[model samples]
Target: MMVMVLMIASYSVGSIKVEAAEELDLQAESAIIVDAKTGKVLYEKQSDLKLPPASMTKMMTEYLVLEAISEGKIDWDTTTQVGDYAYGISADPVFSGIGLIQDKDYTVRELYEGMAIISDNATTITLAELVAGSESEFVKMMNDKAEEMGLPEYKFVNSTGLSNEDLGENYPEGTEPNADNLLSARSAALLAYHLINDYPEVLDYSSTMMSELDDQPLQNLNWMLPWEDNNFVPFHFEGVDGLKTGWTQEAGYCFTGTAKQGDRRLITVVMKTDSKEERFNQTKKLMEYGFSQFETTELFEAGYQIQDESTLSVEKGKEEQVELETSEAMEAMVKTGEEDLYELTYEINENNLNENGALTAPVEAGQVVGEAVLQYKGDNDYGYIGGIGTEQRVDLVTTTGVEKSNWFMLTMGAIGNFFSNIFTTVSDAVKGLFS
Candidate 1:
């Protein structure tokens, strides 16, 4: 028999399967939380509202630079000379510079770390120029990449998410002037998904809390990394590691963050928050809510015995029945209180079997007589259901062969054995008589 388990996780607007304690009150102007593995939106509010991403836009810079290194277009050891524009602001504290020096070269690795760890605008712009010849051209690359990743709403006028106010909007005629990096919370989350999924090595830089460049302490503005008590962190939540943070007079405070607890990893975004503290506090709350309301569940496990209802009828086999069992574990993430594992709908695939009623007599143990589909109720996309949640594949394993049985079969079997058993006895008896 073949069984596919589709689990529709419990979470409802009216008595949702994974309902919040109450309507979660959030301070951010727009926010969203997603499962990194599945891309399921655990919670979202005004997710599609267009907003400035601020320094979080650097995720794209990080992505482009990393991809360039991966494709052999550049290497970590390759050095780039800081442009005059980057050098001028490299030490501008207001713009978050890493003190890049003009005419001086820094390797791709060093620039990447400076940008990702300290949110340094100068290093990021320098790397962008290295990859695309200029920051404006790099902005085009960022937009092009976003489009390929299916993020239509992501528009990058510059490498940094800084608003137009931060950098004067007017530019010399014919020059591509800077604009705010506008992306919806949803779009930001999707960008994060692509960045992490495509270039996981990005976490190495984004996860750092404190580091230095030539002994100058480069402190991370993101405070939720370790979730421990310290003066550096105003709010603490366990399992958060990476992404980026952003702020501007027009953009306010924003964060694209990731956290992992056990097997569950989440990506969350908050936009246009009132203050630095509110963003962290809200992010912590969002992570806490996710961990509290949902759970990762094993829909089916290896060696799991099929219930009586899951068994199937066999045909033309010695065995009257066969059982559908899982040879490997199948798991999913569901709401906290959700009890139903998954919906297992099964039918014996008849393409291979010559006859239907019971499995054909030649059936062998471990043979795939059927397949198992995984799904759930109410949600066709929950967990392994809609490609929106955790994944679990069912490896079907059949029991030992029940060798064919029939009157004609028995006669044929006996006749085939006559030469070895009956014929030998008859020959021995004749020899004895002749002697």
Candidate 2:
């Protein structure tokens, strides 16, 4: 949608090629890393391959629950009675679940903690049922929310992410009994991007390495977390924090991980790795590559005036032109030393201009005239998530107002223009006659 005009160099230099993350040899079937703040993609590998998300599908459930709570539709303290279906799943050891007693009321807070901490299937189903009255209805919400969030590839058949067949006779009504929730690595990463951004408190639950559910010890499945006493301390990475992990025969070992060091937070997704540890290992590689290779760099400061194109001609105004500037700073995740590869380009809002491409008189200061967009001149700019807002841009606004010329000044200008046109016509005739 950006109708770009001319580009201006943001930095004076660049030539040293920054290494791209494509060089990373991950063992996963699909993988991706993205900047949490901007949703900018740092790396991707077979990212569009649709694969089972397994318990990572619970992230959608987690998002909805938090969103519901935030909307006051449901409170954490609100209680929902566990039905026969959820209780049965809880008692089954084949699936990951903490036991739930049928017909017993459990607070949303308790069920959410159980689902998030341990990937409890029954708790997930219970929360789904609580939110939408049935797991089937919750699946509709899941698919609808996915579309709304702009996930490129995802399908939800049940709230728990278990193959509906795995749910046996209890599979939600009006769903394919054998269908399992599926998501591409890019979709998973984008979902996590929205999740942590929209509901940061999910981290409060995800970051807890250990908690108890009904006296039953619950352990976080994400081993890459920086818990000091972590049994998987060998996999721990500094700054690594809360995220979800998953595994099933179909999903293999999948993990959606996020970590923050300073103001930069990175989200990673690795799917269908050989082992539980391999998923974390692949994620660690992505984390290292992102942290080491990228930094949040300011490409252009707010109010940066583009040289040569900084002013707009104002027709019938006191001033011939009015100054323009960027309304906000343009910052993006750039390779540490590759800041110069980006240039600032601007697009004029033609609708705001006259046929002569000049602003009408009485232009207001700070009115949006166009957009200032960032253009990368380097290799492997993976772009942002969803591909909709790929262009990083800010509003191009007027730096100062331009008042309309007084009637006398306007009349004088018109008279001068009329004579100038006649003189030009006479001069052209004389030149032709001389020739």
Candidate 3:
């Protein structure tokens, strides 16, 4: 019996060790795993570290261009003029050009395609100029947007990722190189998050592995694109889609990848990896780990019914009770082994409830009142993950006055009014005499 007890204790300790190792495997040195729905950082490592983001900066460029088109500042078919500044930048050996002609016109859609699909440096500059009047001004807008999004580390000196030469046209020459267009992996991931959520159509372009422009096949620069027998491609991972990839000798391999299974979408970022293949492999491993270790569980349907209370009291009102309901659905992300550990709890705002204890007018059937918090009773440190909402609506049968009314009470009220009017008359006469 003693030996058996010792064996059981040893097995329990070993199992715990294995579970701890699995949990640690979910993180990387410079990585983040975020929920596409709530923008929650489910897992992270040095996620806020400021680093060079290379071509991934183009995600912002692409996003702003899309916003311009959607807001009517530019149209898909509208032609934008390519100026000398765009042409000059394109001529640089390090920059990727779409062969934009000076003072020539290309449709807004073409410029977007060049920038997004090919990561064309010149086309991006032209689009920025058209949308914001100049790249310098556009960089200011980019930085402003980053600030608006609560990202303090990002700065933008140029729309394209090309190195800025200080030959200052705005100031005297010999000024320092503008360090404006710099971004950390976290900021890039935020941009990707916004793009995927706001204008998902951008993925329609980013996900395309190949597109033909000017009679040339513009293959996607992201090595994750499916191809045969390349060390960069992961044979096991499927359903992987394009996002953006970046590399400069200064900033090592960086990639932001998004993958989906059913309604669940995940965003992964890897930065400063040693080699091109390592970036892809690391991303693949992270994505695989996420998909395999977790599953999405819908805690509530969007319009599902919440609890109904038989009696809710109204203050200083004729009615006695009000009904309660939920305003919106609740959902949660749960770890694989701890699905049964979560429970929803709720509360009502007694002050806002109507005379009949129902929710007051301007209340929709599916409006939220109080919140339902998910509590984890499980032993694991993984914890709980969901919120429930308390909601209320008018009882339609009562609102329509379909219920029986007291005829005896109405008769008594009429009789009381006759005597009260006589008493009011006598009191007024006596007051007039005194005056």
**lDDT (0 to 1) per candidate:** 0.73, 0.88, 0.62
- Measured on C-alpha atoms, candidate 2 has an lDDT of 0.88
RMSD of each: 10.6, 2.6, 10.9
On TM-score, the candidate that comes out on top is 2
Cα error of candidate 2 at position 295, Å: 1.3
Candidate 1 per-residue lDDT, tens place, 1-435, comes to: 332332222223233455553477999999988888766666788877998888888988888988998999999999988877777667667875767667777888888888988888878878988998887788778888988777746678878766644556322122345556789888888889988888988887788777777567877778887735576456767787798999988789999989889999888899999998888988888888888887776655565654554455665556766666666765555665443635543445565455544465656777665555555554423222122323334656675556667878667766877767977898999999989
Q: What's model 3's lDDT at 167?
A: 20
The alpha-carbon lDDT assigned to residue 391 of candidate 2 equals: 74
Worst 10 residues of 3 by lDDT: 1-10
> Which regions of candidate 2 are displaced past 4 Å?
12-20, 414-435
| C-alpha positional error of residue 290 in candidate 1 after TM-score superposition, expressed in Å | 1.4
lDDT of 2 by residue, 73-158 (tens): 99989998888888889998887568777777889998998999989998998899989988889999999999999999999999
Candidate 3 lDDT, 1-435, residue by residue in tens: 000000000001111112332454522347766666656455566767787777788888888888888898878999877777777766655565556666667888877777777788778878888888877678777777777665636766677665555223531122236453566656676778888888898878877777765666777766666656465456335656758877766668878888877877888888878877777788887777667766676554443333443223433223433344334445555556555555544455445555554543333332334434444454543211111221212211111111223567557766898899999999999999999
**Against the hidden reference, what TM-scores do the models get?**
0.72, 0.93, 0.73
Model 3 lDDT on a 0 to 1 scale: 0.62
Cα misplacement distance, residue 295 of candidate 1 (Å) = 2.1
